[model samples]
Target: MHKLNGSFSTGYALLTGLMLIALAPASSAQESKEPDIVPAGETKTPKTRVLELGAKLLQSNSPLKRFDIYLVGFHPMKDSPEDQMEAHHYCHQVNEDFAQCALFDGNTADANLNGIEYIISEKLFASLPEEEKKYWHPHNGEILSGQLIAPGIPNMAEKSLMKGKMNSYGKTWHVWDTGHEGKLGTTLPLGEPMLGWSFSRDGEAIPGLVEKRDKKLKIDTSEVRKQREDLKQYAKPQSGVDDLKGKFSRPTRDIPGVIDQGNARSLPHTTE
Candidate 1:
């Protein structure tokens, strides 16, 4: 009787072990198959497609007509009326034309049509004919593009003596200091670089330039509030991913995937 009991116990244990093994792979597979914008720890094609499409749109060949532009919560356009005015004043001081854009919410006053939440910049802004200029708010980059932080040029000394070199554009240009700017964003209107003005993450300055600025000298007022009573809300973090998914009509991924990889999956992150 003792021998029989031992055999039965061993048999039962073996059967249970086999059952777990049989089910393990399917469970793991299900978890892996959960909706992902990009494959876990892998590159996502949708991300690349969005970037490529954006580039194509920027190029003369894209068929995009009247894309609805949007701004984020903390940038110049997102500030209160007073802060918005300040940003405008500052942009004008530097000769930039950045403006505040917003949606057609019922609250938009006839006078406040200038404050729409989307800004049209680059060739898109310039593409409008002269008559359209009245309809299109002036983009500030034209005024802000040449702001300087350098000592006056020997032959030409003026307030525009940017001691640094132009690095990138964010509706405004970013000039990297020869290395003495304190508290980044000290000099000009480059609040955040939205458009790729050709500088690279590798710090390669265009193709022929090889000078390093001491520090970022521009005081990019991308998110400064001009008023005290205004509140701002950023579009959900997954907004970009959703936009891409919608554009392609592909399956959408969770917000975590979008945040973990900004357009690029497998980006190395720093921990504090």
Candidate 2:
């Protein structure tokens, strides 16, 4: 078990410096796939822009500065499995075992802030009450299947980060239904907040959901999955992996190393 120690901290500092330099230009590889959604609201005037610049220069944004890690993944509404959207997460690693993220519809400057997610280590998750477990979704499926990725980071750094997050769980809530993948969403945040869940099995995500994301982001999820094959050994059966089972119409295949808690039958042969 690798602890988040001095070496990791040094690496992260270096990585942050690299990212800052690399992203100095407008055309950054780390930029989100899509542009800002919906042509709603009036354009900003010179006065407004001046005021925003002043705030940026003078405001104490210490909390915002902590959000250095950028991750991208898809989340489906727990109640409505088909209601899925790509989530861009700007996260702060509060500690070795916990992280909090601000979820957005896109990664652009104009992206909509739609949700929030709290991540916890497996150890922390184990301490959670059994009845409360359903609120958290396992991360092994997302990590091993390569559905979740930290964009712009080196492979080694990303893998190290993902390895630390193995067996973790995240509780997410989407408060706004911003438009996604050409679908127009509510002009404003409407209705109650929706709980978000992970895609445990292959094909659970709606057709074209991952495809469109991969195409736009220039990522090959298959290759990323292959690269992460070694991380499977760290995975364990997690609660909520089967919560959405049989919900999708598509034929689903079991992702190796990702099984629901207590469902021995669903465990991959390799794992056993």
Candidate 3:
């Protein structure tokens, strides 16, 4: 197991402070690319606002307060790879090996709560039944390709968090299709919940999906990927890496250190 270092503790403290300010009730200063369909309802009256204010002051929100880590990534519907969308994850580390995240379509205050994801370490995942393992997606590809990132924290803190999650897996279910980069999303969270999967190879994601996110967030995936090349030493052969291998519209290519568990013996764990 990869042990937690002091850097992780320092990062957690920084993240906690950021989350406190983020969770405060505030206006939507930043708008989401996919806006929620405004449901039919009457405008809030002064009486309603006052009542809400009282409830906010009196009601206990302790459970919601611990979701301090914020991450951004994209998910392709497991059954339909063509249907993909960006996901914003607000997570709480339940323990060293478990986490639960609330999924949103964007990072703004008005972002829609579209889904939920449960994350677990490789040790816990290994104990699951074979049938149940199919639902979870591997993390090495997402981490190594620089597609998954913690947006608001310092670079060192984010890297430490990602390193800790090198061999983890996530089971995600997106309950809504809030659209993609250029298109407008459904006004309502329609249809059955979609099981989300990771892009384990290059060119698997729809064209321009990752670029749009990088441009909007002002970060470079290439630089991030270079920074994480060293993390490949910790990579392990994981399940679900090849589940969608030939399913993408474009041709795909391998990323070093990411392979299916069936090919475990063929891959090297370290460069040396």
TM-score of 2: 0.87
- Tell me the tens digit of each residue's lDDT in model 1 across 22-77: 55532332111011111124454898989989988887742223221112111112
RMSD after Cα superposition, model 1: 29.1
| Regions more than 4 Å wrong, model 2 | 1-28, 180-182, 264-272
Candidate 2 clash pair list: none
Question: How far is each candidate from the true structure, as Cα RMSD in Å?
Answer: 29.1, 3.7, 4.3
Report the lDDT tens digits of candidate 3 across residue range 1-272: 23323333454665555555664421232224444455335899999999999999999989999887778899988998888888999999887778899999877666788899999988899999999999999988999999998875556657878887888899999887787555667877789989999989999988899998888777788899999898887787889999998997688999997989888776555443
- Tell me the lDDT of candidate 2: 0.81
Give the top-scoring candidate (TM-score): 2
- Per-residue lDDT for 83 in model 3? 83
lDDT at residue 82 of model 2 (Cα atoms):
81
